[model samples]
Target: MHAHTATRPVALVTGAGRTSNIAAATARTLAAHGWDVAFTYYRPYDARMPWGAEEGAARALHAAITEYGARALGVEADLADPQAPARLMDTVADRLGPATALVLAHCESVDSGLLDTTPESFDRHFAVNTRAAWLLIREYALRLKAPHGAGRIIALTSDHTAHNLPYGASKGALDRITLAAATELAHLGVSANALNPGPVDTGWMSAEHARQLRSATPLGRLGTPQDCAHLIEFLCSARGGWVNGQLITSNGGLA
Candidate 1:
């Protein structure tokens, strides 16, 4: 049953497991701008992190989207699986129609240096952050039914590689994959770009760490999920279609 009659564009945002995260913010912002939003989350990943899973966050996000007069679907997806990307794309298409915007905010980030990083951990990071992104983009481009120049792909990336080798390396690969979509998917008129939103504390930072970062940033505060969400809202808009194929840093000039 197709719920989309093209009355509003659809957006597929991954990693929206937590209501306070960037992906959740992006989903709500897009919905407010007349988009039907479908988001994926893996609670197991959040459970493994220092910030344990937020129970019922996805339900709350769906309710929020509906409050904005937009349809919403939440799926529990483990992007580490090679098959998950295609399944995700298909599920979103079946429910809300083909997504015009694909926001990849999912990641496998476990802090380990070159010596401490295990082979299994490295492989998992690449599987989730790099290969999954590539596969998702491929699925999206192939299944795209949106009109020409209407497709958008936005990937969130980071450059923190000192103590976090595998995560950063895989993200570097993701950046390349996203940028390649800009040229390769040109035939389909899909504009792709990577965005680095530096140090937005979504409950992972110590108070001291947050204060240090706040003082370091030229803007005298940490970046917020809304900061990234607003920029992504623009990137997914028709007006932002021209600003493609670039790696944009939306950090508040942290030095």
Candidate 2:
């Protein structure tokens, strides 16, 4: 039941939904770099808000990655659950062996304004965006202490955190957690970091929002999933060994 053949390295990516999302791009990028990929998708019953109609998008992403001759497994889990991270790690270990790299890409909130955000919204964001990420990193660190070389843990954050957005504040907390975990895990051969993508052209942004963001960016264009994916790929590679406890922003100087 090993997810990949004994030869390939394993990578786990969370929040890999269908819509050309950052997680999807990261998965493909990792596969291209020769790592078997396993990603998580929230079940339809568990989706709290309308995530658009990208049916079977996760499956398509899995197929695309596997097409590159690497193994891909998609698991459906409720990230809001406190135990989800442990369960996810267990699933990955059972199906794909010990993961050498972990990507925490799951997010559950999209509230635009602070006034409109609810307590439930805050809790959900913290649970999925911050807490689960911490748990994943902890589990990965515990498993990597043996003589298998150092592992990588990359979590996604947002420029909104710098802009004082409520959801972004939660991400800020997640960033702090990453820093603390990185210091603790460094001794165990695990490097933890956060990737903050400024504005991406995901369908999540409205036309007006997209225009404003693009105009504000010095690059005159919004970020793309591939942009984030490339950085993630580099960080997960041997070359990124020295990068730990850093918050690398991938924005086009929009901040």
Candidate 3:
């Protein structure tokens, strides 16, 4: 492994779609903690995917990270493509040396319920959520192996996994996939873990929906991107090194 100067670390975060997006918040949080960030976004042709607004969001995040005095690269990629993860990683490495931290937060097709879910939908989710994570970890391990200072991989899961929705099931699969990788990579100085969040107020959820979720949550409030980002920032730090192979739920104390 090529050694990097110990002064500041570099991180790559995928799926940072909007400034209010959880992944974008996590990137800013990490930057505040002194890590340079490289982030990715997906642009879909569909009118529902909010692809057109991502460039503006990326610009805002770039400003936030820079305000923290860290370098930031905001890349637009289509994670639905099987080869996109490797290409995204290459872009990140080209912009900011080898990464010490990686965050897989890309998600697609949340509209697929059990009755409407198709094989194609399942495969798409698996490819973008689980398989992409696998490819990223594989590449990360190949590059940084043991003797490196506790490389970290953090995957964003969903509370729906526990509720067993079709989309949730996909996230559950992602959690399991991450755990398997963590078990194998822990001995090699890398740690992998998943973070699950409940209903978050990301402006995508309607006000009525957010209010209903807040009523259901024990904390009497809906989660915010910043709430999730705080925990992710901790996970990427030295303070969170011992937290490995676990699916941590940050749902305002909700089960």
Tens digit of per-residue lDDT, candidate 1, span 117-184: 99999999999999999999999999998888889999999988999999999999999999999999
Candidate 2 matches the true fold with a TM-score of 0.90
Expressed as tens digits, the lDDT of each residue in 1-255 for candidate 3 is 113345567888988877777888899888888888999876562235643465467788889999988999988887767687777777777777767888888886456566667888778777777777788778776666324546888998885643235567767788888888788876677778998877778777777877788788888988998998888888877778789889988888754
Q: Largest TM-score belongs to which candidate?
A: 1
Q: Look at candidate 3 and give me any clashing residue pairs.
A: none
Regions of candidate 3 where Cα sits further than 4 Å from its true position: 1-5, 45-47, 50-55, 145-147, 161-166
Alpha-carbon TM-score of each model against the true structure: 0.97, 0.90, 0.90
**Where does model 1 exceed 4 Å of error?**
1-6
Q: Write the per-residue lDDT of candidate 2 for residues 135-252, one digit (tens) a residue.
A: 8887777665233334788888875743345678778888898888777876667788988888777677888999898889998999999999999988888778789889998798
C-alpha lDDT values of all predictions:
0.93, 0.80, 0.77
lDDT of 2: 0.80
**Alpha carbon lDDT at 142, candidate 2:** 65
